[model samples]
Structure formats: C-alpha cells, structure tokens
Target: MTETRKQLLQELAAKNGTPLFVVDHEVLRNNFKEFREKLPDVQPYFAVKANSNPEIIKTMFDLGSSFDVASIYEFKLIYKNIETWPDKERQDFIWDKIIYANTIKPFKVLTKLNPYKILVTFDNIEELKKIKQRAPDVGLILRIRVPNTGSMVELSSKFGAHPGEAVDLIAEAIGMGLDVEGISFHVGSQCNNFDNYLQGLNFTHSILKEVALRNFEIGFTDKEGKKKKVLDIGGGFPVKYTPDVKSFSALAKKLNLEIKRLFGKDNIQVIAEPGRFMVATACTLVTKIIGKSIRDGKTCYYLDDGVYHTFSGQVYDHQHYPLHAFKDGELKLCATFGPTCDAFDTISLADELPEDLQIDDLLYAENIGAYTLASATDFNGFPVAKVAHINRENI
Candidate 1:
C-alpha cells in the first residue's frame, strides 16, 4: 500500500456509490514499469480483456506499454482513443498489431478486417481454412494446446489446437499462403510459479523447432525446414492480490534468461500478454457492509457487491483483499458476505476482520481490476458496479 491508496480508500468510503471500482493510476504505473524492466525487449502487451478500463489503459500508454486485445471492439477502443493524439506527429500505437487471440475466429470478421491489423489464431483445420479463404494474406500464430497446465484461476477451456495438431495447422495455413509466424499458450492465471513461463516458452520453442521441419520452405516453397518469425507465449503474470501469492522474481529472471537462451536473444521478440498484473493491484473494489451475522463459530459480512456482479464467489483461489477497518475503528474477527440473495454470495467466508464492522461501513477490497469487472453482469436487477479512477498520481 502507498500513501495514495490509504488516502483514496478513506475518500472512497465517504464518496457516494456502494459498489465502486476505484483504480490507482500510480500503483498501475509502477506495475507497468516493473513489467517493462523485467521483460526488457519483450513487447509487454497489456491484455485489455482482463481489465478494459480506458483510464488504466491511458496510464499504461503514459508508461510506454503496448497492448494485447481480443475482439474487434477492443481493437476499436484503441482506435477511438488514438484519435485524441496529435496527427501531425503520429504515435506508434500497437493496436495496429494487436493479436486476435480468439481461437475460433469467424470468416465474416476475418474478411471484413484489414489483414495486417490482426494476428489471428486457429484451433481447428476448418478455422484455418476459413482464415485462408477469408484473409489468406494475414499473419497468424496457431494457438497451441489449451493448457490444463496453467494457472487454476480461470479454468482455460480446451479451445486451441491439440498438441500434435499445431504443426499440421501451421503447414496447412502456409499451403494457403498465410504467414504462420509463431505459436502461443497460457500456463495459467494468477500463476504462482515464474518457471511456468520458462516451461511455456521452452515448450513453444520445442513446438516451433518442429514446425521448422514442415518442408514448406519460406523464401523457397519447395524446400523443407525454415527459420521462424516470432514466438508469442501468451501471458498469466501474477499480481499480489493476496499475501499467499508468491513473487517469482528469481523465477521470472531465470525465465527471461531462458527465453533469451532458447530464442537467440535478438531474432525473437517475446510477447507477454499480462492482464491481472497490469490492472489487478491498480484498482480496489469499495463495497459497503449491508448486513452481518455469525454461524457455527464464524462471522459473516454481507456486502453490496455479490458474486453475480463481482465473480469473487466463483473464485476458488481465496483472493485476499486488503480489507480496511474503519468507521467503527479497531479490529476483530468477521467474515464478509455479498448482497445477493443467493446462499453462496459469500465474499469472505471465514476471513478475520475487525469486529467493529457496522452497516454502511466501507471495505476497500484491493486488486479488483481484472476479471471481476470484465465478467460482471446484472443479476436480479443489480446494477453495474460504479467505477472511478483514484490514485496519488491522479491527485
């Protein structure tokens, strides 16, 4: 926590809105710089799908961060904002090169899109043919095995090509004159082990090395084996959402070295599409205590923000939110709950908190900027969470 976070929490409590998404721009900037420094030459592509707050995206831009977006709407968001820049001196916004990470892309979307703007991914052979038929001139990186191996945060569904299928897909795409540039995968979200990156990158290298033997000689179509263009290993860089999250700086350092070691340091540019690390700690959810109780030797605090709207209920990782004890001052044990009528709208199931909790008292839950907002919806007419950008940097 920084001085800005402390002051902002105090202010957010007084500010109107029960369930609010308050972002700390300064905190976000620090995280952004950390990614830039650690990855060195890697294009730190901020995943907008994780936390699509334009304000935070602007903060990233100020810190010289590139982005990794999914949909055309997301890519359009970048274009919408880019209009504000001085056209006389154009800035190189990476939106032009945002990866279209959706494993199953539609032919309609591909045909309508300017080919160079999207780095399309395909899992099935039909999808690759669709890309070929619709936009054959485009560059693509086959999304390899949907990792049952990555972070257990959001269960990455089996959406990409199977282990042995990636090379085949690449070969077919090249036969269609499509540029099969590289490969990518997700180890997990909120990934605890930085070595997971090395594992993923090394795995991608192994796969690419195999693709090199495809006999679809680039610069000479009849020849076999060719040098690859890029290796884009998708991101799951962890942020300190809770005390339990182990920092893998040593692991990350080793992974960086390994990436340079295996990928020849200069010819390949690694792309880290970090979502949570970019925006998690940068924002906090300010939810008010709506009700409270005790059962089976445990305390429960029902909050205005529920799992339906926050998705914290479905989160099994037990994300430790830096719960604040204010209004009634001092601290004691209390479990947090959500406002939803569902019996499972529990936020803090057995978490200890200040016994001073009272109705209307505020709890600033740190690291709420990522999946919560992106996955939020109105259940039982519950309104969308009000969002606000707050930080010492902004002040």
Candidate 2:
C-alpha cells in the first residue's frame, strides 16, 4: 500500500467525514496499463458497470480506455456528464467510436439512441427476430453466455446457449443477414480456476472459426494496436477481491496461450470487457466510528457506511476483502457490521475485526471498488457515502 494512498484516504475522511469513498485515479490508470501490457494484443473497453462515477469514467477515458456499454442506461451514464457524449455533439455521432450495447432485450429507447455503431448481443433466435423488428438498422454481436463450470460462486445458467448450440445460433444470424460483426463470452465473474477461462476462450474462438469458415466479411485481424476487427471476451479479466482467488493476469496469460494454440497465432483483435478487475481496487469507502460494541467477547466496529450502500452483493458472491483497523498496529480478530436496519448488513465475518478497537475509532477495507457504489440504495433512507478522487501525483 502506498503511504500517500493511506494518507489520502485518511485526509479524505478528515475532509468529508464518514460514509465517504476515495478513488485513486492513478491506480485505475496503472490497472489499465498493466492489463494492456500483459495482453497488449487486445484492446480494453472499460466496463462501466464497475464504477459509473463521471470522475472515474473521465479518468478511464483519459487513460485511453474504450466504452463497453451493457445497457442504454449505462451508455447514458457514460456520456451523461462526460464532455464527449456522442449525440449531444449532434453530427454523424454513430461514427465516433465502437460502443457495444452488450445487453439482451434492449428497449426501444435503447434503439433510438444510436444503432449504427451500437452493437447488440443476441442470445437466441427469438432476440434475433426482435432485433430485426425493433431495431432494423442495428448490427449485432452475439453474446455467447457460457455456464458456470461450477467454478464460479454464481452461475450464469440463466443466460446464453450451450456451447454446442452457439454455433448454430451464429449460423442462423448469418443466414438472416443480420449485421453479425463479432462474437463474445463471459468467463464467470470472480472465477478462481483457470480451466474455466480456457473453456470460455475456446468456445469463442470456435464460434469465430465457424464465422471465418462461412467466408463472412468479419475481421480476424487489424494492424496490431488498431481496432479489433474480431472477437471480444466479456465478463472481465477477473480480479480477486478475496485473498484466495486466482490471479487475473496469470489467467490472462494462460488464456492468451490457449488462444495462440487455437489460432496458430495471436493476431485476433480481441476486446475484453473487464469491470471488476480494473476498478475493484481503485476505490475504498471510509466511514466514521459512529458506534461500536462488545458482543461474544469481540469488538464490533459499526461505521456509518451502509452495507446496502457499500457492499450489497459482496457476501453473496463469497468475496473476502482485507479488513483493517485505523490505528494499524497488531491485528486482532473482531466483528464488523454496517449501520443498516436489517441487522444483516454486515460487510465482514465476525472474525475480521481487531481486538483493541474502541468507540469513535476508524477502520478501512480493501478491494472495494466494483460493486460497492453501483448497487447502493437509500434503503433505510441512509444518505449514501460521499466520494473523493485521488490522483497519481498525490501517491
């Protein structure tokens, strides 16, 4: 941990008080650089689902990350406050850059925004039929939703077709003359086992091969560093919020090797929609020691950060982020909870808190950028955490 980051968070806490989030802009840029350095062959479209803050998005855009919109709402959010919002400029806006509307079942509002360069994902022939009727002018990228090899905590058993059927779906789309540009897949979020990643890339490459064999005009290569005229890997380069989760960079290398072996070369222009990894560690939420308790011989630090407002789906995903006390001395076991009403809004296990904690004490958690703010709600009518941006200069 950079001393400056620690001090900045402390300073932000001092400046904004409890229930606040501080984002390190430099960490985000470094993350993008590291991922690109490792997979320099592929272009990264910053998955905005992780952090929708205009500041963070502007930082990412300034770092040269492309846009990967999963929904129209996310697209709006990305451009809402940014100076480069596409149509707001009002001139042949669809030609600006590649913005993929990567979600299934887009509404008419979504189609109305800009369907020219907007890529839609078709899971089945039904959605295919709907796209033809709903948004006739749009090109489509089929989202090949692969199931959890039971390797991930949650399964996307709800989305996409089996690998065997994905080929036929792509073929059907081609037969319909739907503007099929490229293919995509989601290696289950928070995946630990590397084999799960290998399987997803294999599936996508297979479909791409089928598309190639069909003599489709789809691009398989661009002048390296140029726009990928090929396939995309959605569902991110996985980041380990938990200490025990596998390394995302290692998995990327492994998948890159598999991709080379399959293609006999690494020329495919790949687009990765990485949300969790890029931003998960770029931000941390800080709260005041509004309250504390001693229960079952353990110190419970109840900060003002609401669990629903901070980490809504974290526990359900079995993420074990590092917990730390403010004083930063000897670590001890203690329970940590939020100031929510249900009494179930705890962010950590009962064993994570320190032993010497006291009333009005401060604490911090790490690897908290991804789902922390996006899922926040005013449920208990609690005011959400305030935010502060940190730059590399400070670090």
Candidate 3:
C-alpha cells in the first residue's frame, strides 16, 4: 500500500470508526479506464452485484458506465439513479445501458420488468417458457456454460447451459416469438486461466456461424437489417490480489490477439460483465482487534468484523485477503476470528501478526471490495461495515 492510501485508511477509521470500507474513486476510475484502453472494441457493463454502494455506482455513472444487474433490487437501484439525471442526459443510460444478466428469475419479477424492455439472459427451455409467458418483448441473451478450470468460484455448476444445448434453446426462444438478441458465457469469477476464455470464444464463434447457416435471425439488427451479434464474455477478469495472478493488461493483450485471430477484431460487438476487477483493488477494509487470547499455543485475535460481515468473501467466494498489521514488533502466528457467535466466522486461520498487537490495534485487508460486503448479513446482530468514499473529484 502507498503512504497516501495508508493515511486515508487511518483518517477514515478515525472518523467513521473501525470495521470501515475505504473506497477510492480514483482507483475505480483508473481500473475501468485501463480495461477499456486495452480492449478498445469491447463495451464493459459494470456488474452491480460486486459492490452496490451508491457512491461506487455514482462514480461509475459519471464515467459513462453501463451496468450488469442480476436482480430486481439491483435493477431498481440503477434505474432510480438514472432517473435522477435530466431527461437528455439520461437517454443514453435508459435505452441500452443495462443488461439483466441473471439466467433465472421469478415469474413476477419478469412480468414487472417487461415494460423496461431491458436485455436479459437465459440458459434453458423452462426459463424461455417463463419469459414467453411474462415478458416476451424483452431482448434475450442465451447463457452457455464454459469451463471454470482455474476460477476461485466455479459458476458453471449453478448457471449456464452446455453449448450443445444452446442452439436448441435459442431456436425454442425464437419459436416462442421472443427476440433472440445475443449469447453470453462466464469463465467464472477470479479466473486466471486464459485458456478457459479461449475455449469459450471458439465455441461462441462456431455457434454464431451455425446460427447464420441456418438462416435464423438471432441477435440485434442494425438500421440496414444486418445482424449485430452481441458476444458477452462474462467477467472473471482477475486483479493483483496476489503476486502470482496475471495482470489485467497481460490478459487483455492475449485476449485481444485471440479475438483478432478468431473474429478479425470487432467483427462482432463485444461486452464484458466485470464485477470484481472494477472495485476489488479500489477499497480497503480496516478492522480493529476487540479481544485477544492464546489458543492452541498460538495467539488468537478477535476483530470487529468477520464472516457475516466484510470478510464474508472467505466463506462465500473462497478468497483469502492480504492482511497488514499496523503495530510494529516481532511477528507471531495468529488466528483472527470475527465478532459473530458462529465458530465458522474465522477470518484467517493463520496470519503472521505483530507480537505486540493488542486490543484496539488496527489491521487492514487489501483488495476486498468485490464479493466481501455484497453478501454480508446481520447475523448475530452485528451491523455491516460503514463505507467512506474518497478521492472522488481527483478522478
């Protein structure tokens, strides 16, 4: 961490109290800009499920971001934000700035979302039937299953259809009188293996050609009625949470080369659903030791936040945050536990912590902005960590 970032985190903790999330808009803007610069032809739709703090959303909106929403609650949040702007300024966002990326949704939610005419994703025939019954007017994107070989979270188990089934699903949607506008797939979250994406792209190319050969009018069309296929390579773009992971620029270069080789660069309109990459490195979680003791001959510390709070990513996303202790002393092995009553609320099973650390001593975690707080709960009546936005205008 930079001295400036450390100072900001200390100041935020002093003012907002411990167990706070310090978000820097400058980092957020730089991350987004970096992705766009490397992949010039791709449109990035910020995935709202990563971190739904209104401040983050506002910063992204000001930078002309489109969104990837997964639920009715997320939809309402983005819709209401766009509603706050003037009509002329909001037209860009209202028309085509969002995609409902969830493959499964309740019938009532689908019915309620029909009037918006937003784009949505589905992976099966049953989902197509539900959409046909409730919201046939909306644009449809088929979600296909791809390999999650090196991803921390393998989404294929819960989402996506096999490529063999995608053609039939799209045909069924077309037969039901729905607008089949695109195809999508996730390489999984926190995926470092680029081969997963390469395989997915190859499959997508084959499917597009197959659709074309069959004379199926899939995907959106231009004014001249030319088919404009939307290729949504869903987000899993990893960040530098650890030294071993590949950098975004390196991954982008490889991806750019593959895209050019396969589709001749920008032949098909491309989009990405980036959730963790956009905000993962932008926010730091600051927590303080509330109690301490020796357990099994190792120093054990209890913190104000844990599994039901900001560190929820450990249990949910299989992530281990990089921890930094502020106190100065010889290092000792320590186990950090959360404030929750559950024993599973362990934050770190083993950490190299300062030996002189005591109650109220501050410790921080880096690159925790993504899946951390988004799924946090009030279990044991512990409140969620407060968020403080910094470096806004500097962006």
Candidate 4:
C-alpha cells in the first residue's frame, strides 16, 4: 500500500464511517481486459454468485461481459439491466449473455426459466427430468465431475456428474426430446492444479467424440449460419491472492494450447465462469477498532466487522485478508476479533499489528471484494459494511 492510497482510505472512512467496503471499478475493468487478452477465444461469464452487487453487475454489463447465475434471484439481477430493451433484443441478450450455471435447480426455477430459453447446466437424471418436464424450452449443458484436487474449495463432491456417466446422461436427455447444447466442467474454485484443467478438457473431448459416434446432434446454429457446439469450461480461473499462488497468465497459456490441440477444428463456443478473478482484488474493506485490550501478554483488538459480516469470506471462502493499520509502529503478533459475542467471530489470532494502535483507528483489508459481503449477515445487530464506489465513471 502507498501513502496516497492510505490517505484516501482514511478520508473515505472518515466520510463513510467504519466497516466500509470500497469498490474500484477501474480495477474491475482492468481485470476484465486482462482476462480477454489472455484467453481471446473463450467468452467470460461473470459469475453473479461471487459478488452480486448490482453496481458490479452493471459494470460487467457495460464491459459487454456475459453472466453465470446460480439462482432465479441472480438471474433477475442480470435481467434488471436489460429489461428496458425491446422484447426481441431482451430475449436475444438473455440467450447470448446469460447462463443458469447451477447444475441442480428446483422445479419452480425450471418453470420460471423456461420462458427465457437460455442455456443451463445439469449433472443428474433427476435434474434432467425436472428440466425436461418443467422447462423443455431451455438448452442444456451436461456438467461432468473432474479432478478438483488441490483447489481452494472442492466442488466435485456436491456438483458435477461422474465423467464416465456423462455421455449416457447426454443421450438420455436427447432421447427425452430435450436439446443437449454441449458439455461443461468445473475443475474447482481457485484451482491451483493446472493439470486438473487439462484432464477436464480431455474428458470433454472424449465425451464429445462419443456423442458424435452415437450420431446425437448437439449444439445450436449461430448468427453466422454455422453449427457450433458449446464447450463451457466452467469457472476455476485462479486469482493470485498470494505470492505462492500460480498466475492466471500461465493457466491461460496452457488452456489455449490444449484447447487448440484437442478441439482446434471443432466448431466450439468456449466459455468460462469467472467469479473470484473479477472482483477479489477490485475492492477493499476498512474497519475501525472498537476496543483494545491485552490477553496472555498479547495485544487484542476488536473491530466492528467479523466472520459473520465483512470478514465472512475468511470463514466461507477459506481466504485470509491480513489487516493493516495506517499508523506506523513496530509490528507485533496480535489478536483480532469481530464485534460479535461468539468467539467464533474471531478474525485472526496471529494477525501482526502495532501494539500501540488505539480504539477508533482504521484498518483495511485488500483483495477482499469477492466473497466477503456477498455472504455477510447482520448477526448480533451489527449491520454489514456500507459499500462505497470509487472510479465508477464509464471508461
């Protein structure tokens, strides 16, 4: 952090009050541009579940980015942006720019999504049946279980069908008079093992080949009048949260080479759901120390935000955002806790901060824009962080 940045944060905190979340749209645009430049062939669907702030969604919309929504509420958030357009234009935008990426959706959601006729993902037979009966108009993408090893969050156990059963499920969907548009897979969230992606691509290739052998015609025709198959290489684009984490540029290079080597000649529309990569580093959280004490000869500081609020990402996303003090002093091991009564609200017991820091002093955490506020709760009568936008002007 620079002195200018620290001064700005302090000013923002003074004006907006503590437990403030600052979103920098300029950073958001740069992240989007980086993703596009690195992987030119793949279209990005900003995962709405990552941080469904309407302003963030609008920014992504303004950048011409597609969306991957997990629920009907999220679907409507994207729809809110285009509701004023003509009916044809609205529907076209929905088809082209939105995907209900949640593999398991409820019957009511299926019936609700049927009118849009957009693309959706499914992994099991029950979901397929529900989609066939309740939402037959939508396009389908089969999600196969791939290696989630060494990922920050493992998703294969809960989502994705076994790769071995992928083709059979596709065949069954087609037999039921439903359109199986393509195949999709998620290596995992914040994936560290790049080989997991390679294996996922190989699985998709083999499944598509088998589907071809079975003479099952999948995919839809694009405006170019060419038949194109949808190859949704689902979200797992790693973000460099720390120095040890691998770079997305390296992964993109590998993906470009492997995608071309395996399906170079195929008419495939490759897409990805990038949730954390887009917003993690684009925002920062500033909180105020409400109390100060000493425990076991170690300094303890309590903030207005905790695990149930702005710092919830620490508990849910398995990420650690080391808090920093604006005042310069010798650093020592300290404890940080949230405003909540439960000890479970502890942010960190090993946080390093100056021992002389006093109450009402400001501390901020960077790279906390992704999952923090999205999952926050107003537990113990403590309100979630107030969000303030910076660099929000159109670029």
Candidate 5:
C-alpha cells in the first residue's frame, strides 16, 4: 500500500469513526476487468453471497456482469436494479443476467422464482420433484460433485450430486418435462488445486456427451435465437490472499486451454460464479485499539472489531488478515483481541506490531472484502463496522 492510500484510510477512519469498513469502487472495477481479460470466454456472474452490498451489486450491474444469487433476498437485491425496465426487458434480464445457483432451495423460494423462469441448480431427485411441483417453468442446471482438494473451504461434502448419479438425475429432470439447460460443479472456494477444475470440466463434458447419446437434447434459445447449452463452472476461483496461493492467471490459462480442448466444438455458453476473486482485495477494515494489557510478558491489544464483526472471515473463511498500525515504531510480537467478552473473539495472538502503541490508535486490515462483513454478527452488543465507499461516482 502507498503512503497516500494509508493516509486516506486514516482520514476515512477519523472521519467515519473506528471499526469502519472501506470499499474502493475503483479496485472493484479493476478486479472485474482483470477477470474478464484473463478468461475472455467465460461469463462472470458475481456471487452475491460473498459480499451482498447494494453498491457492489450496482457497480457490477453497471459493468454488464451477471449475478449468482443463493436466496430469495439476494435474488431480490439483483432484481431491484431492473425493477423499472419494461416487462420483456425485465424478464430477459432475469433470464440472461441472473442465476439462482443454490442447489437446494426452499419450496417458497421456488414458488417466488417461478414467475421469472430463471435458471436454477439442483443436485438430487427430491429437489427436482420440488421444482417440478412448485416451479416447473424454471430452467435446471445439474450440479455434480467433484474433487475439492486443497481448497480453503471444502463445499463438495455438503453440496453437489455424485458423478455416478449425475446422468440419472439429468435423465430424471428431462423425463419430468423439465428443461435441463446444462451442467455445473464447484471445485471449492479459494481453491489452489487446479486439477479439481480439470476434473470438473471432464465430468461435465462426459455427462453432456452421455446425455446426447441418450438422445436427450439440452439447452435453451437466447434472445438472438441461438440455442446454447449453459456450462456453469461454479465459483472456486482462488484469491491471492497469501504468497503461497497460486495466481489466478495460471488457473485461467489452464482453464482456457482445457475448456477449449474439452468443449470447444460444443455449443456451450460458459459462465462462472466469482465471489472472493472480485471483492476480496477491493476493501479494507480500519479499527481502533480500545485497550492495552500485558500478560506472560507479552503485550495484548483489544480492538473495537472482533471475530463477531469484520474479522468474522477469520473464522468462516479460514483466512487471516494481519492488522498493521499506522504509526511506525520498533516491532515486537504481540496479541490482538476483539471487543467481545468471549475468549473466542481473539483476532491474533502472534501479531507483529509496535509495542509502544496506545489506546485509540488506528489499525487496518486489507483484502477483507469477502465473507467477512457478510457473515458479521452483533454479538456482545457491538454493532458491525460502518461501511464507507470511495471513488463511487460515475461508475
């Protein structure tokens, strides 16, 4: 970070008060642009569950990005942007620009989503039956289970259908008078293992080929009347939170090459749900040291934001955001804790910082945009951090 940016963060913290989460819209745009540049063939659907801030969604909408919503609320958040468009335009937007990616959705949510006829994902026969009964008009994407090895958060254990059962499920969906648009899978969140993606692509390709052999036609026609099969390589695009985490460029190169080798001749419309990759590094959190103490000959600093608030990502995301002091001084190993009463609120016990820092001094963490604020809670009566955006004018 430059001195100018650090100074700006301090100014924002002072102006907005402590425990402030700052989002730089410029960074968000740059990240999205980079994703597009790297994977030109893949359509990025910003996963709203990562950071569902309205402004972030609006910025993404302005950038002509699609969305991947997990719930009724997130669906509404994206729909709010196009609520004023003409009836056809609104329906078209929902069909082309949004995907309800959650494999298991509530029956009420299915009923609510029926009118839009948007694309939704399913992994089991029960979900297919629910969709057929409640929202038969919606498009279906079969989510198959794949390897999630070496990912920060493993999701395959909870979601996705067995690869052996994938074909059967697709056949069942088609047999039920439903339109099976395509196949989808997630490697995992913050994935470092590139093989997982390759395996997922292979699985999807095999499944589609088998579906064709069975004489089952999948896909839908777009507004341009082009029949395209949707290939949703679900989210798991890794973010470089640490030096050891592999670069996205390397993954994109592998993906581009493998996608072409596997499905280049197929009429596949590739889309990706990228959550952490887009907003993880575009925001920062500034907190104030509320108290100082010494135990076991080690210094401990308590901040206004804790595990229940902005640092919640540490617990939920399995990632760390080391805090840094604005003032320069001799560095020493120290401990940091949140304002909460529970010992579980500890931020870091081995933070390296200046021991001479006093209470009310400001500290900040970078690349905390994803999963942190979205999972924050108001435990111990401490309110979540106040969000302030920069460079938000004119998109």
Candidate 6:
C-alpha cells in the first residue's frame, strides 16, 4: 500500500470505526482507464458479481462502462442505476451495455429479462432450448471449455462445453432459429497462464473460420459486411497481489499481441468480462483485533471480521491478503482468525505480527474488494463490514 492509501484508510477507520471497507473511486476510475488504454479495441463489461456495491456500479456506469450480469438481481441493480441516466444513454444501456454471462440461469430470470434484448451466454443445448423458449431474440454467445491448469479457481471443470461439442451447439442454435452472435470461454480466475487464453482465442477463431467455410452468415459479419465476429474473452486477468504475480499491463500486452496475430486487423467485436481486476485494488478492508491467545505454542489474534465478513475471499477465492499490523514492538509469528465460533474461520494460519499488539490494534488488508463482501455471510451474530466510499476529489 502507498502512503496516500494508508493515510486515506486511517482517516476512514477514524471516521467510520473498525471493520470498515474503504473504496476509492479514483482508484476504480484509474484502473478502468488503464485497462481501456492497454487494450484499446476490447470492450470491457464489468462483472457485477465481484463487488456489487451500488456506489461502485454507479461509478462504473458514469464512466460509460458496460456490465456482465450473472443473476436477475444483478441485472436489476445495474438497471436501477442506469435507468436514471439521460434518455438516449438509457437506451444504449438497455440495448448494448449489458451481457448476461451466466451459462446456467433461472428460467424465470430468462423469461422476465428477455424483453431487455441483451446478450447472454450458454454452453449446452438444454440451455439453448430454454433461452429459445423463454428469451428467443437475445444475442447468444457459446461458452467453450479451455485450458485452465495454472489458475487458482478452475472454472472449466464446472462450466464451459468441450470444443468438439460446441461446434454442434452453434449449428443447433442456428437451426433452432437463435441469434448466434459469437463465442466465449473463461480460462479461469486469477489465471497466470497466458497460454490458456491464447488457446481459447485460437479455438474461437477456428470455430468462426469453420462457420464461415460452411457459409453461415450468423457470426461472420464484419464491419464491411465481410468476415468478422464477436469474441467474449471471459475474465481471468491477474492483479498484482504479490511481487511474484504478473502485472495486468504485462498480461494485457501479451494478450493484445496474440489477438492481433490471430485475427489480423479485422474489425472483430472483442469484449472482456473483468471482475477481480476491476475492483481488487480499489478497496481495502480494515479490521481491529478483538482478542488474542496462545495455543499450540503459537499466537492467535482474533479480528472483528473474518471469513464470514470482508475477508471471505480467503476461503472462497483462495487468497491470502497482504496484512499489515500497526505496532512498534518486536515482530513475532502469529495466526489470524475471525471472531466466529467455527474453527475454520482462520484468515491466515501463519502470519507475522507485532508481539505487543493489543485488542484495539488495527490490521489493514489490501486488494480485498473482489469476492469478499459479495460472498460474505452473517453466520453468527457478527455483521458485515460497513462500506465507506471516497470520491475522486475526496481521495
């Protein structure tokens, strides 16, 4: 964390009390602008599931950012905000700024949201049939499986259809009278393997080539009415949590080169669904030590918030947030845990902290905006972390 961020967090903690999440809107805007500058041609659809805070959504919406919604509630959230925009801007939001990216969705959600005419993704024929019956006119993107060996959270095993099976899925969609827009695949979350994305892009390119060879005009309409298609590169772009991790700009450079090499200078409508990368570094979680004990010849410091709160990403995303303990005493190895009855609420099994840490001592966790509060639960009587928003001017 920079000195600026630390001071900002200190101010927020002082004002809002402990167990607070401080979101800097300036950081969020800067992150999005950097992403756009790095990949100028790729349209970004912010994945709302990462941190669905309405303030964050409103910030992104004000920046003219698109959204990738997974559930009806998410769509409603974005819809509720974007509805307040100007009439023309609201129409654009209704038509083009959103994509329903969840392959498996509730039937009621599909039936009710079909009138919005937004883009959606599917993996199997059953999903296709459901979409056709419930939401026929919406644009469709086929979700294909790709390599995800090095990712922390492997999504391929659970989602995405095999490449061999996807060919028929496209053909079936065309046969059943569906709007086949393009192809999409997720390499995995926190994916460090650039090869996985290259492989997925190549697979999508080949599928488009095959469809073109068969004279199918669904996904191949270029800007000049020739040959081009949309490619939804599902998000897995890594953020710099630790020094060993590859920076976002480095990965973006590699992916951009591969995209140019594979598709040439064609006017392909490329888009990315970025969740973690968008908001991970934009917020910090501040929690205070409530109690401490020594067990099994080691120190254990309990925090007011844990896996059931803002640090939920530790259990869900397999993340070890960078922790900073505030004290001048000698350093000692300590274990951090949430203030919960469950033994599994440990935040870090092995962490270093100041030996003189007291009950009110605070610990700041950085890069915790994603998959944290969004997946948090009130398992015991403990409450969710209160969010404190810092606008650009304020930050």
Judged by lDDT against the true structure, how good is candidate 5? 0.94
Per-model CA lDDT versus the true structure: 0.68, 0.68, 0.87, 0.93, 0.94, 0.86
- What does the lDDT read for residue 172 in candidate 1? 79
lDDT of 4 by residue, 85-118 (tens): 9999987898889999999898999999999969
- After superposing candidate 1 on the true structure, give the runs of residues whose Cα lies further than 4 Å from its correct spot: 1-4, 83-96, 146-150, 154-157, 215-228, 293-299, 311-322, 327-332, 392-395
Q: Candidate 6: give its CA RMSD in angstroms.
A: 2.2
Question: Which is the winner by TM-score between candidate 3 and candidate 6?
Answer: 3
Clashes of each: 11, 1, 1, 0, 0, 0
**Candidate 3 per-residue lDDT over residues 252-286, each given as its tens digit:** 99889887888884347788999999999998999
| Model 6 weakest lDDT span, ten residues long | 219-228
lDDT of 2 at 33: 86
The sequence of per-residue lDDT tens digits that candidate 1 reaches over residues 225-276 is 4343556667777776556767746556777778878877434546767888
Q: lDDT rank, highest first? A: 5, 4, 3, 6, 2, 1
- The list of candidate 4 runs beyond 4 A from truth reads none
Candidate 5: how large is its RMSD? Answer: 0.8
Better of 4 and 6 by TM-score: 4
TM-score for candidate 6: 0.94
User: 97 in model 5: Cα distance from truth in Å?
Assistant: 1.2
After superposing candidate 3, which stretches have Cα over 4 Å from the reference? Answer: 84-92, 222-226, 265-267
Lowest-scoring 10 consecutive residues by lDDT in candidate 2?
88-97
All candidates: TM-score: 0.85, 0.87, 0.95, 0.99, 0.99, 0.94
